[model samples]
Target: STTAMAGSGLFRLPAALNPMDWLAQPDKPGISPEPSYQRPQGGIEARAFGNVVHLLVESMANAIARGEEPDVTQWHPRAHALLRAEGIAPGDLPHQTQQVVRALENMLMDPEGRWLLAPHTAAASESALEDETGRHVRTDRTFFASDAPLASGEGTLWIVDFKSSENSGSDVAAFLAAQKKLYAPKMLEYAQTKRAQLGAETPIILALYFPLLPALVYWQAE
Candidate 1:
């Protein structure tokens, strides 16, 4: 069955996206230096099932990074079985990601009211954030790692990292916290530049999306 749904059998969807682009920061978008978050929001395509899309993208990227074409038409099934073996077969990936996106879209900058921060892409895993020396520092390394607007309509933005996993042998909260800690410095560094460019306030938000258990954890930066 080509992307057929029979109570969900883990078939690869027709869209096999390469996630490598996300791993390495692409050229920042063209922002007119406004009083906003720095990471420039909303340019990537965001569908309802964003995490699924991210999964597809990461799978493709991993393959292509090794110089192989990602054939989603016949790879997801094998991946699914691996998840099952890990004792984490979650049918919630799609909907959970959708809900997170909706919530984020509704999130507004505090005190004042503004809603333009858009979450265009999903990272699918924090494993994507590589250091300058190329050290993959993220520990959660779960599923659906992404960045969204920090609810501040204005420069220097914060990234929202979503952790999606079945929790077979993992602690969701701990994983979430660790990712935040690792990214805090990076977020600040990004804010420094963004604020300078747009005279925007530095990022004042941090978030985590747990798609498997349908949980969202966030903090407002001071």
Candidate 2:
């Protein structure tokens, strides 16, 4: 199996492949590698905005795990302080903080969101996975059923990747279609790696959580 080969280091795979890389069609005989395009780095304001939202969500999840309602007001100050400490401009903090607060509020109100964020015995944030050959992948959040069986189709694992695009637009259907095209292979890779580490039969669900949009998109491994 590809997963087994990856874990055993018997197969030489690319060290890392982003979603776009996985989406590329290089199998055609006439195909040539696309010219490298260096995307511009997100401005400090944008970077800080995402960082602040992520921090708020992390804190909220932690609070939920501890049986407490997350205080957005408290987190707002903390996020602002963090941005200041990191040299992020203060001008963007207010709007970004409000965005984070609204996202959290929506998540708390949505039943599916609440379920996904529910406290679990086995949960990890910013989890890292690496094979013996140093090939690696990272996930934003993961939850495993505590008593799930390792055998095929008897247990479930949930892996989430967060996206922070403010420009995803109002067309949910179109956005989802594009997202599936871009992220399907990457999510499958993450699931395959987890199966290799866990067991072949354990079912995995990969999710893309857009906190700013307050949306949850998911795919299940076959």
CA displacement after TM-score superposition, residue 83 of candidate 2 (Å):
2.7
The global C-alpha lDDT for each of the candidates, from Candidate 1 onward, is 0.35, 0.58
Residue-wise lDDT of candidate 2 within 1-222, one digit each (tens)? 000101111111223422233222233333223221112237766666666666666677878899998775676677668667656656866776677667677777776666656765366555566543456455667775322212122134677766666545667767755766687797888888766666566656677766656666765665
Candidate 1 local lDDT, 44-130, one digit each (tens): 222223333334434543554456744534544544443333333267433444443333222222211011112223322333333
Worst 10 residues of 1 by lDDT: 1-10
Which candidate's TM-score is highest?
2
Predicted structure 2: lDDT = 0.58
Model 2 misplaced regions, further than 4 Å: 1-43, 145-154
What TM-score does structure 2 among the candidates reach? 0.70
Least lDDT summed over 10 consecutive residues: which range in candidate 2? 1-10
